[model samples]
Target: MKKTTLLILLLFSLKSIGQQSKLKITIDERIETLYSVAFFNDYFLINNHENLYKNTLKNKLNILKNHKAVQLFDSLSTKYNFSYYRTVEWILQYSNFPEFNKTKNKADDYSTVSENKQFLLEEFKDELIKFNQDTLFQKYLKAVKPLNAKIISQVQNSTTIDELPSYLEEYYGKKLNSYNLILSPLLHAGGFNSEIINENGEKEVYALLGPNGEIDFVPYFDKDFIETDLILHEFGHSFVNPLMVKYENHVESLSSKYFTKELEKNGTNQGYSEWKYIFNELLLRATTIQITRQKFGNEKAEKLLNFEKSVGFELVENIVEILKEYELNRHKYVTFDEFYPILIERMK
Candidate 1:
């Protein structure tokens, strides 16, 4: 009887571990609150304070802004072309804190901020250490920790994280359980962002869930909202970015022709180099629209398309016909490799 019980318990434990949700959600109140302190301080420094979180954060942001640690960060930012907030991000990623510890790879160098191939944090390691030790940042973090429960509830209601993978699977007509998702609910003040990083020889997506201004203070749950759109948009990057890199030569050859001066000038707003940026932007946008249309009906998809156009992706609507053709004739093109080249040829 004892042997049977042990075997049963072991099997149950294995089952539980195996059945764990591919979508892992965490409300990293400390990291988000820390970033909020920096972001709000930066915002106030540039413009008159008009944020919704001003009343909750003004004093904290002010204190952080005046701290010697932040001053050192500012000086370093000038030298490095990366902001103090970015340094804080790197600190949280590298710190003893569990929330951020697994978000970066052990192999990648953190000397420079990865995005945009920007400045070196290695040069200012001492300054970064000093900034992380600042009493003000710690105090502000403690003061705001109590509000995390409420903030987490608000963010959960505003976005649909739990059902996202299932939605993506149903839309794309494939199994996506291999891809692990890290849903980090950031403070309402911080903006939304997402990135894919390789950690422990596995690809993990760290996505920031921020304020949904569309339904501000009106508590309701709907995955079809723009919150889903934002997630799909970022997730689309995880799909398209790697493929672009995999087919770098093919992408480069086509990019020069497709990326006209008009597209370059229009797409440079995000600081990405013109042709490469435009190509990625269009690929991600089209992927977003295709999957969104599958999950939601035509009306919602049309709204998403127009929204992309209004944001300066004026050529996206024309791609829909080609994507439709791809879907109808999918058997001919088994992979994106087969489909993408043909699609680009049609673009010509």
Candidate 2:
């Protein structure tokens, strides 16, 4: 690793908040504003000025050090919405966007499906209470509820129109028609995936909306996927998003040393990292396939991996560019070692 990267490693390695690492620093100005402190134990948001808040954080950090709460807390983050982060995020956005605060303290971290949107909101308050008791689902409270309309009205809390186009125009024989098929992205900040909905001239899309606040795309999931796994594969990014956020600075500065041949042998192949962009994207897709299989099941995992190979390296690299441009990329287990097989496996 480079000297600059090494500095980051040494900083976060400490258990105590010793020198306060800049591991979370990045060039993405928008993202920096969304920062929050995560209690390593419960993997929940620890950002707030309330006394109860600091008390909760201290208690959790103590448990984290003892390794006693790891299982329950880990389960909350790993399987569910991992809302801790998003909650912290939403609140920061919330304080700035007054509309979201209208929901009172009774609101819990639960979801409810309904025919009438207004009735759903009313029923949700009741469900949120039950959700918090689960220890498992409570983590998603921040992400579970919808954004206050007033909050969403602000440009900061919303996304671009094309960022997630609900319709696509595909060539089908001799005519052109509107297809509900689409891509739904729901990673940390959303816009994380693509899908082809099987809506027979209708709209049918869905969002992951994991129990933890870490995964909630309901806002954008106004349609359904033609095939379930196709969207899930993309939603898989939610699980992978935290891991990547764990390395936020790494990618922000990836370009700094990304394509440099500085570490290569005197004169040989493509340098320290060969195949560069192709290799990078191949790994991203591989990680997505692997993690989704592990979490949801292998049902369509293998097939998706096969699809990558068929897509060929060039096309895959182009796709990667799109992902990178949209700031939607991640690795499976949040480590460099795990990133290799994922990168190479996608090579056709």
Note the clash tally of each candidate. Answer: 0, 25
TM-score of model number 2:
0.23
The whole-model lDDT of each prediction reads 0.54, 0.31
TM-scores, each model vs. reference? 0.72, 0.23
Best by TM-score: 1
lDDT of 1 by residue, 194-299 (tens): 3324455554554444443323432222345434476676555555565676666766777756677767766875445557557777776776687777766678
Global Cα lDDT for candidate 2: 0.31
Per-residue lDDT tens digits of candidate 2, residues 1-348? 699798887777764465332111111111111211234342323322232223433553243333323333344345544343333222222212212323222122333222343343333223323333334323332332233232223212323222221211100001112212222112222222212222243312222221112113222222222122333333333334334445444544444433334322211221114334323344456545543444435765556556665644223334343333222233333433344233323322
